[model samples]
Target: MQIPDYMVVPSLVVVVIILLGIAFWARYKTVGPDEAMVVTGSFLGSRNVMSEEKDRKIKIVRGGGAFILPIFQQAEYLSLLSLKLDVSTPEVYTELGVPVLTDGVAIIKIGGSVEDVVTAAEQFMGKPTEALKAEAQEVLEGHLRAILGSMTVEEIYRNRDKFAQEVQAVAAKDLKKMGLQIVSFTIKDVRDKHGYLDALGKPRIATVKRDAEIAEAEAVRDARVQKAKAEQEGQKAELLRDTFIAEAEKEKVLKIASYKREQDMAKAEADQAYFIQEARSKQSVVDEQMKVELVRKDKEIELEAKEILKKERQYDAEVKKRADADRYAVEVSAEADKA
Candidate 1:
């Protein structure tokens, strides 16, 4: 190790290269996507055409790395992300002379364009995020008060979106001076010392509820009427069905009675015919007996003739009685039909 005289120069050269590389690495600065690295002091003039009117020696790098000369240049980061500011203004008089208190929030951020970045660098290059937020909030509050003074409490309460727009319109000009932009402006609350908005809405709410109740009652009434009509229709249909059934039953009964009456008449006619045939045979037998008696004795023949006449009269009377009975049955059937 002590005999390396020729390697000394090469060793020193390698050490110098390594040291230079370390220095270069140390001067290399990077800016994240959410931030802009502002390099100032002894930098070349700005390349932005919009900033040509003003002489500013600064450079801004975003989402990339840049080489910074340690002795001549300094780097600062300005967040590109939005910053939220809460604004609460004292009681301000509206056009209608009503005192109103307003609370709101604003979202703002540094402009990302070349001109905007140059302007932001000039105004807030070394400032913290809070300082930018305070500046934006102050501008927003002042414009909010001015807008509120031109609107009534009712307008501020009802047209909250318009109120926010008006405030943003007025405040944006002031913020643009500092190279800031308003992303959103919102009215969180607007109130008065007295209960004005609540009193204004009470009657409207009551009217809406009353109208709803009336509509509900009308619906219920209509439902009841429809139900009653349906019940009536059902009853009418049932009554009609029962009437039809009763009429059908009456016709059936009439048909059955008529059939029975016809059967009875046929049976009666058959019985009458058989009775007449039997009477004729008895009369013939009586005649033969009388002839035999006449041959035996004249006195016996007279008595037998008288007996035969009596039997004939009795048969006639029995036929007449049966005919009267049949007529009576016919009359009763006619009366039943009429009834």
Candidate 2:
């Protein structure tokens, strides 16, 4: 078939546009936040900024877009998320010669630094998360076994955090070479076939119980002694109270007796004064009667002296009259004789 001359120019232009569109689409690729896109190919003697060596030309794009020459470069993705692994070891002998099995878990991820990403790109590029987990589990189990061999079973059981730390420290170097880092490692359990841990704790438990019983007995003895002392104090207080009451009664009786003696003395003094007053009154009456009888005897003696003087005067007059009669008779007789 012969083509038209004007149709040929337009057909050539349409073909160029289609090829350029295809090339543009193939050169531009977008990478997600959790993924790194690695591009590798011949660079026409130009240096690749993502790689240090000029012979092995490669570029890594993360969280953005990159341009790739259609035939000179290729693109691949690696996950940036963490991976979990299970760690289990068969029965292993400890430093104390005890056989034990250990079970644990670990979390790992590809490092995010430029150097670490380069390492990850060279080692784990295009590998699945399961493949990375399997690799990490094998490395961690070996380390766990080695650490267990250096420690006693009691140390492993009591300090699981320390045990995990030791395992992570030892395994971190190897995992780093494979471009992975351990976020965490934990030991879930440790067990033995012979029940050695249970047997080891028995003596300590028995000792604790025995000490508790002894403390309880000592506390009871102390309480009994305190109770006895309290009873003795109560009895002494009662005895003191009774003695005080008895002394008080005796003092009251002595006061009453002394008061009665003073009252008796006062009564005796009053009676003696009354008797002396009565005797003085009787003696005054007898003295007045004796003075009246003395006056009556003096009047009787004066009357007797007057009566005797009158009788003596009468007798002297009678004698003088008789003598006068005799003298007259004699003178008459002498006259008769003379006649």
Candidate 3:
């Protein structure tokens, strides 16, 4: 039984076409940055993935290649990008019972673990990107309110380091719940309750005022004591100087009087000695005149006695011659011879 020749050639051509179709089915795929892999056809809802992460443990499907069951495998991309969250704090009561209003910015991004993708998938599965962003804003407000309200205003100012630490602790916990990890939670401004700072400053000002008054009083007392002591010392010095001057003047006067008295006594003694010497000289001249008068009286008495003796001698010679002449006849010759 030989078949027709046209039927045999057409059958060979149909077999080659079937083999080419099978080869084409083994290799066609597409992957992008923002999409995650999804199982299709026979591998639907399974761990098979086609992603840019080549070393990923999840099943990988290559680009531009045909998978065995593409209908059971698929990829849905999710964005991994940074976001900004504006945190606005309510006028909440602080630990010191003061109402405060605060506001700041929060920086957040996706977590590092594969659980991060798993967590994002759960919350925002069917939701849009804007809805997820709004949820992040609400979380920022809640974390700031809980952390900032626990501190007083003075403590916050003195210990901003501690405030930042507490914010990190609170944000890390709450952001995890919101499918976010905080890069930073910064407080930009804090508006305090009305008139509370002024109240605290009043007591410290009064204490400074009291100290100033005490210092002023002590200075005044020290000045008055010093002035009184200076006056007393000046008066004492003046009196001592006057007493010394008067003593010196009295001594000078006494010395002058004693010198005058000594000179007067010396003059009087010199005059008395001169008068006694003149009287002794006059008495010696009078005694010499009395001796001369006694010598002249002795000379006169001796001359009168010599004259009587001469006259008696002459009379005796004449009487003897007359008797001799009368007796001349008998003894005149003898009398003349005896004469």
Candidate 4:
């Protein structure tokens, strides 16, 4: 078949556009939040490292996108997600030679530093996540066993947090080499084969039970005695209250009687004073009347004496006139005889 000349240029242009789209899609790679993309091959220069001692040619991308050429570089991922491990140790000997069984849980993850990512890429490349988990579990078990061997059984059982902390701390030093770390470690339980813990609790339990019973008995006895004493005190207080009330009532009555007597005495004295004042007023009136009567009698007696004197003078004057008339008649008769 012969190709048309007018269609060749447009078809090449379309082919070029499609190739560019595919190249853009292939070169730009994106990683998830909990994932690290490690690209390693020729032409990858030295990336960020922790120290000058370690120089590695690798590019680690996490939580973002990177440009990766498809031909010369190979890109792989190591999960940054946590790995949960169940660790169990059976018939482990303690520092005091006591054999115990212990169980625990651990949360582990690959370190996120640039140097740690490079280290982890070197150790766990081309391996499954389960392989990483297995390595972490072995390391945790070894450290747990070693720590338990160094402590007593009491220390392991009672201070489980301390035990877990020591184990995690000691294991972290070793795991950092493999670019792994422990987020948390917890002791779940501890057990013994010969019933030592149970035997240790029996004596204390019996003593506590006995003491509780004794305390209950003493409380009952004391409660009864206090109840009796309170009742007796209540009765005595009631009797005293009655006696005091009776005495107060008697005193009130006596005081009322005395006040009434005093009021009556005052009234009698007021009546006597009124009578004496009336008698004195009556005596004063009688004395005034007697004085007026004596003055009238004296005036009558003086008038009677003046009347008796006037009568005596009249009798004397009449007698003197008669004597003078007799003497004059005698003289006249003697003169006639002589003639």
Candidate 5:
């Protein structure tokens, strides 16, 4: 179950009236920014405070709040932000007593001690601009000259690293009695005449540095171009070599084919020689057989001639014998008749 809120109006009225009665005891509040409790008298050493006077004082320097009395003395407002005093002096003399044109920078906020603050307040007290400048020229110039004389331009230029220490050292001794601590001091205008810095010829250095960059870029571009050309030439050579190798391979194939043909032709010649030799041997055998047949035919003819001559001689012999017998018989018959 939800419950409703109750208002205690009678109790709240009593609490408000009780708080208003305590308002007359007198609380202190800094109107602006004051962080620390105000200690009365010179801030260098005294911590002595009357409880009555404590409520009357406050330190109002920067952003924040602190306690103070609603009555008696009020808090003083000192600006805590960075401040500068631009100075131009003409009366300063170097250790060489050479007159110079000088400019100064005073980086300040607030003094650390009451004694320091009192000195700064008295020196920078209310005056017209012309009078203040005149006083700064007379008093501050010598102090600047003395400090700058101990250092050179090189030292001053490089001294920006520990500027606070240098300023503290230079201004601390004098301004300590015046209740001020300087953050830094800067000397701006050091004139060596218009021609002095130009006489060093720094423009040549800049020109040389620029020219070096251009030369480096040019060299890199030229190298890349040359490298690309060399790569192209190498590729061309490789291509030519490949073409030559292909041509050589083709020539080798042609030579191999021609060699094979020559070998075939040689084998054909050898076969022709073998066949011719076999034919000549066969022809010699046939010629021998023909010569033997011719000799046999001539012998047969001679034998036949011999047989015909023998037959004719035998017939003639028989005829002669018969004629001889006839003659004998005639003679015998004639002789017998005579007897």
Candidate 6:
């Protein structure tokens, strides 16, 4: 077909734009967070990798995008994500000559440093993550067997953390050469055919039971002793109260008896005084009557003596008169005879 001269320049411009867009899309590449983009082939000079080995020629891109030249550079991806390994060992004899089986789990990954990535690219660039996991698990199981042979069954069973640490420490140096790191390693279970562990716990259980019985007996004895002491104190208090009451009653009785005795004595003395006064009054009346009788007897004797004297004087006078008359008559008769 014949093309127009003015249309050829515009068509050529449109074809160039479309070719450039396709080339740009094909050259641009990106890697995610869990992927490492490895670029290998001819380079201008040493770049994007930190490896001391001159023979390894590779560039690693992680977590970003890069433009790849089509002919000189080929892009390959390596995994940066962690891998889990189930590590187990067959029955192996320990240091104590006891056979044991051990099981464990481990987490491993390719190291993140530039040197580690470069080193890993040389060894494992074409392997899958599952192939990496199998290779790491084999190394771990080998170290676990070596550790078990050096330790006794009791040491491995009782101190699992120590056993795991020893295994990790020993395996790290060998794994580093392959550009792998041990994120974590732990022992899950340990088993033996003979019953050695159960026999070890029996003595401690017997001692604990003995101590509990002794403590209970001592508590009962202490409770009984406290009850007896309380009863003794109660009895002593009652005895002291009874003694005080008896003494108070005795004092009351003695005081009442003494007061009654004093009252009887006072009454007896009053009666004696009244009787003595009455006896004195009767004696004074008897003495006055005897004096009056004595005075009347003396007056009667004086009157009788006066009457006897008057009668004696009258007898004497009559005798004198008779004598005088006789004398006169004698004288008269003598005179008549003379006449």
Identify the leading candidate in terms of TM-score. Answer: 1
Instruction: Give candidate 2's error at residue 84 in angstroms.
Output: 1.0
Regions more than 4 Å wrong, model 6: 1-14, 44-47, 50-55, 201-339
The reply for model 3, stretches above 4 Å from the true place, is: 1-69, 193-339
Clashing pairs in 1: none
Query: Compared to the true structure, candidate 3 yields what TM-score?
Result: 0.43
**Which digits, one per residue and each the tens of the lDDT, describe model 1 over residues 1-339?**
473989899989999999999999999998899888877767535442232334646677878888888878888888889988999999899999988899998889888886677788788877887788888888898899999899888788878999999999989998888889999999999887777767766887899899999999999999999999999999999999999999999999999999999998988988888899889889989999988777778766666787788887887788878888888888998888899
**TM agreement with the true structure for every prediction:** 0.60, 0.54, 0.43, 0.57, 0.39, 0.56
Candidate 3 global CA lDDT score:
0.67
Question: In candidate 5, how many clashes are counted?
Answer: 5
* lDDT of each residue in 30-116, candidate 4, tens digit only: 999998998876666555423333453678888987767778887888889998999988788889998888899999988989878
Which 10 residues in a row give candidate 6 its minimum summed lDDT? 44-53
Alpha-carbon runs more than 4 Å astray in model 2 = 1-22, 44-54, 201-339
Instruction: Tell me how far the alpha carbon of residue 96 in candidate 3 is from the true structure, in angstroms, after superposition.
Output: 0.7
Per lDDT, the best of the predicted structures is 4
Clash statistics: count for each candidate: 0, 0, 17, 0, 5, 0
Scored by lDDT, model 1 comes in at: 0.84
Q: Rank the candidates by TM-score, best first.
A: 1, 4, 6, 2, 3, 5
lDDT of 2 by residue, 143-238 (tens): 999999999987887788999999999999999888789999999889889999777667867888898899899989989999898889888889
Candidate 4: minimum summed lDDT over ten consecutive residues — where? 47-56
Clashing pairs in 5: 28-68, 55-69, 116-178, 116-179, 117-179
Question: What ranking of all candidate models by lDDT puts the best one first?
Answer: 4, 1, 6, 2, 3, 5
lDDT of 5 by residue, 281-329 (tens): 8888778877787778777777776777676677677776676676666
TM-score pick, better of 1 and 6: 1
Flag the better candidate by lDDT, 1 or 3: 1
In candidate 5 the C-alpha lDDT for residue 73 amounts to 40
